[model samples]
Target: AKVVASPIELCQFNGISRRDKTAQQKPMIEVISSTDFQVLSCINQIKQNMFLQFPERRLIQYDCGKLQTLDVLLAQLKREKHRCLIFTQMTKMLDILELFLNYHGYTYVRLDGTTQIVQRQMLMERFNSDEKIFVFILSTRAGGIGVNLTGADTVIFYDSDWNPTMDAQAQDRCHRIGQTKDVHIYRLISKNTVEENILKKANQKRLLGDLTIDGGSFDVNYFKKNNIRDLFDQSSTLEDIVRERNEYQQKLDTSRTTIAVAATKTTTTTTITNSSNPDSNLTLTQYEEALAAVEDETDRRAADELNKEVRNE
Candidate 1:
């Protein structure tokens, strides 16, 4: 007869040790000049440590980085007979990484937003039990929360989201209560890149920004007082062009909409001969249309104001 596991039994089986050193270890900075080199060196070091600690077995981590670094890291991990769980932010990146890893002769599994709910559970089960498969590349946003990656001892942030809470949640995928070993987190931030500046800004905000904002208003004064100009300066290569084009396009569209709405409003108000009986003459659709026109006009004016603000910046 087949056996079914109970929730209480499963909880006991997956419980983490109170004595886990990884829980107590202070987070350290492992800086390197290049993201690629940092990832390579870190993978090698993790494999060496794994060998010393568990020579008869292998362990891996979730990596979210470029295809090149991931390829090199996977090769080294496989050479040491270790398993890996890789994560990426986008499905496009995941597809590219999957192709590259497969091309390089690695046995791996993947889970992304496209994966069905039922299929995700099956994949997770296979990853936990399979001995031959060495890596699981998942989308961080899709697989970062409510997953049991206790099979992994290390977690790598190949890239980071602007929000630090997301990063913390992603890291917790392996650092949870069931983890037995020291959970080593390796965050790869490219020097002088946007990711580094984002990290600095996120650090200044107590390492979490998503929780601090409410109802569209945030503590902008805190960021201003902190003088975080350097954080916003690391704009991407195409940032200026994209920003300029988008701003210009938004202004033009707003202007056209505003003009059309104003014309309609003027025509409606003129057609309404008696102001005292405006409500009687106006249909619900007409009232809604007028309100929409006013709203669109207000939006256009706001956009113009924002354009001035951007110009000053």
Candidate 2:
């Protein structure tokens, strides 16, 4: 199951974190930099003093919700003696994670785009041979392809990729042959962000693939061009998505029940007609009429039941 980790920025501020906000607002300061030299100079001096006191404090936000969630998850996985592979898209994130692991005293091996090809193989071998290594940190694009890390049973996606298949390929590392354990996969998604939409789109793509492979009927326009805009839509919350899914499921269930009842009724009617008149033959038109009648009856009955429930509510 994909576990969404609500990032601290989105959770605490109800928006992007302070650091991100500051970055966005920093560039605008250039426009007014010369106009207020004295005030800017004073502010810069104070900011420098604060930075000196707390070096890289703003750079390394160790107190985020996602990291907090990761800490707890790692602790639990540690207790179970499980080895984990943590994959992130950015190499900079790997640097932060390395510091985090170091702070927590976790024995981990890392691989990213910067690492040499020879070093990559050696690191993989060492991780596979060494039982002391608790975690393997990797850059998703660099570590996603052409390497096997079956030594780890747990995979954590620190961030999602635009192409879902990249994440799937990364997961296939542990799921390869010679793996004895049941692999657990976790995907951390920031709430009310583009990550949520990315996940939904990934799921839709996977569903489309499954349908195509299984010879299921689907609309050709299901992947229409206009639907691409949904990836950037952040207006819908996770709760809204969950509620919509539940409603869709309920409707699907009701539809299945109605179809089943209609089919049974039509079959019974056909059987009775055949039994009552030995010489009677049911034509295709008659069969269609009977099916249509039962479908209408079933729909009416289902609607009445729904109306009664609504009244009771």
Which lDDT tens digits does candidate 2 get at residues 1-313? 9966667745455667767777878888975786689788999999999887655633444557788789889999999999999998666678789878887889999887666668988998899889899999986666523478889999999888655666887899889988888999998888988778767765555543442212223332333333456767888777775676566556656755765566655543211122333343544345334434654443334334433544576
On TM-score, the leading prediction is: 2
Query: Which residues of candidate 1, in runs, are more than 4 Å off?
Result: 1-66, 207-229, 232-313
RMSD of each: 28.7, 24.9
Cα lDDT tens digits, model 1, 1-313, are 9999886666557684434434544232223336668788999999999777644311122233444465566667677666666655556666666656655667778876556668878887887778687777776666633578777666666667544655676777777776677766766666556666666655544422322221223222233312344555665333443465456556656755665567665543212123333334434345334434653343334334433544576
TM-score per candidate = 0.47, 0.57
Query: What lDDT score belongs to each candidate, Candidate 1 first?
Result: 0.57, 0.70
> How many pairs of residues in model 1 come into backbone collision?
2
**Steric collisions counted per model:** 2, 0
Task: Kindly report which residue stretches of model 2 are placed more than 4 angstroms away from their true locations once superposed.
Answer: 1-63, 213-225, 239-313
Name every residue pair that clashes in candidate 1: 62-85, 64-158
